[model samples]
Target: MSLFILWGAVFFTLALVFYSVGIWNDYCHKQLKKWHITMFGLGVLTDTLGTLLMYLHVGYLIFTAHSISGFLGLFLMMSHFCWAFLAIRNNDLQLLNNFHRFSILVWSFWMISYISGLYLGINGLG
Candidate 1:
């Protein structure tokens, strides 16, 4: 594999770890916290870096299922992060408490994209 692909994979894995920890911790605690928001931000940052690296390696964009899902997942992740920021900023108790449901849904969709990318990568179809 090229160095770009290797580093991209590493960053993507880091994104997964960061995102999972953030979302699952919030879910388990049943509350939104600043730290969780930090994690979500890190997840988005890492994912973006990974995506950029992959794009550089590929030299162009290809509209495939994996790519489409990845874009969607990234969008959802960013939206989730923004929502979390808004909830925290607004300090709405109900919103903070109930945010886990949305977080989990977003996380699930992100996981689907992640897994699909993995499968495609393994099959040399990504």
Candidate 2:
């Protein structure tokens, strides 16, 4: 694989790790925290970097299932991050406590895209 593709894979894996740790930690604690939000932000940033690197490697966009799901996953992740911030900023106890549910849902969706990308990459189809 090219350097861009290799670096993209590394960043994507980091996104997975950051996102999973954030969501899992928040769920286990049953509360939203600034650290979890930071993780989420890092996840988004790394995922974006990975996507951009992959795009550079590809030289163009292709509307495959992986690409579409990736776009949706990115949107969900951004939304989740913003909601977590808002929940903390507003000091909404209910939202802060229950935000893990939404986080899990978004994480699940994001995982689907992540897994699909991995499949595509491994099969040399991406």
lDDT against the true structure, each candidate: 0.92, 0.92
lDDT of 1 at 10: 93
* Clash-forming residue pairs, model 2: none
Write down the RMSD of candidate 1 (Cα, Å).
1.2
Query: TM-scores of the models, in the given order?
Result: 0.94, 0.94
lDDT of model 2, residue 45? 99
lDDT of 2 by residue, 12-93 (tens): 9999999999999999888678999899999999999999999999899988888999999999999999999888888888
lDDT of 2: 0.92
lDDT (tens digit, per residue) of candidate 1 on 1-126: 999988998999999999999999999988789999999999999999999999999999988878998999999999999989988999877767658898999999999988988887889877
For model 1, the local distance difference test gives: 0.92
Clashing pairs in 1: none
